[model samples]
Target: MRARFIFSALATTLIGTAPALAQDDLSVDQVLGAWQKQKQIFHEAQSSGLGQTRGLKLIAVEGVDAAETAPQQGVSVTASTDAPTSTDTTPMDPNKPLVAATATTTTTTAPLVFGQLDPELQVNLQIKFGFDSAALADDQKPRLDKICQAMKLSDVQLFRIVGHTDTAGTDTYNERLSVLRAKEVARYLVEDCNITASRLETLGLGERFPLNQDDPRADENRRVEFQALS
Candidate 1:
């Protein structure tokens, strides 16, 4: 119930609705493209005075000619006659741009940014299980394989395997069933796909989140989903 309420609230709050991601099959390129766009938007929002800004006076390294790069507008840099010696003990790589810090100056530094994909991206897979059993169906293994392939290709390192069930049994029974199904999927991913166990978490939302809310008993309501953690 809580999960359903939260998701519904989020749907209402997010800017204009994003199209739902296709649930038929996993596509690595499509997922990555969406993530990249979201990441850019997240960073731009962070850079707008929301993150910490520190003005830094970049100094030239000794014997290294400093190539001047103009800072963003509204930012100013000042140099001091009493220049501090470079303390960077590490060997310099020729390919890297060189800069020395001398004093405290306020400059806009992008905040530590971590972006989450739009909720519409939560992948809904038709993972089947034997009747009244949590055991995964043999024929449905390929569906899980597709998910593994997508995850390996994606930059996301952690994922949550969320389980749901159709509204058929009691809430308690459905919840337990959902959890067992999710755990089975996670176990398969770890053992069969060589996915790190630590990188996966399982959640049993049970019938709390239904794809076809209008018809709670719809087969589509009984589904497994992938949510990126990081």
Candidate 2:
């Protein structure tokens, strides 16, 4: 009952925004074979003269050059600087990603940026959260249990749990809700499923990549997706 109310309340509310990343992104031990093959499509689109023809933009938070937009109109700044730590206390730009002119990969080479990650990479889980709520819905334990069991296998190494939402609220509201839900789900896996925290990474893309773009209000669009990311 509470979940239903919370879900309905979401339509009128707005959530705050945070940095693009929730925490330090640790390097993956090994990239999954399937993911690598899927990633190849992105690389081809990048190298081809036609450019990232899929309308995808290169976005980075902080793995290489930390570029930020200035408050002044049309003013932007780019520089080679170290990624800031959580403990660093200083007035800085808000946690919006710096856009790059062209498509480029991150970390060991260029800055960490978004790639044309296939939507199929996102696993459809019945994970749902209410507005301004981080608590995982009580339903769908059997489905979640099967996912947890898969992660426990030896062959599977590291994975990412991503949160998404339907087009019901402000982008900021949905983004934060997604993050909170993803973090909470990660917490459950670590504490309840006995999975190592280091092996699981979490992120929230909000409503950017909905499963049912045609019907934005679809419940399946509001979900947590698990992908074997390296």
lDDT of 1 by residue, 44-85 (tens): 434542232121111111211111111111111112233323
Global lDDT of model 1: 0.50
Question: TM-score per candidate, in order?
Answer: 0.56, 0.53
**Model 2 lDDT at residue 80:** 14
For all predictions, the C-alpha RMSD in Å is: 21.2, 15.4
lDDT by residue (1-230, candidate 2, tens digit) is 00000011111112222212111121122223333443344445445632443422334423222121101111111111444232332222323322111112132333334332444333456554444556544574444675666567534445656677988998877765676466667767776788876566556667866667678778777777665533
Whole-model Cα lDDT per candidate? 0.50, 0.46
lDDT, model 2: 0.46
- Enumerate clash totals for all models, in the order shown: 5, 2
| Backbone clashes, candidate 1 | 5
TM accuracy, model 1: 0.56
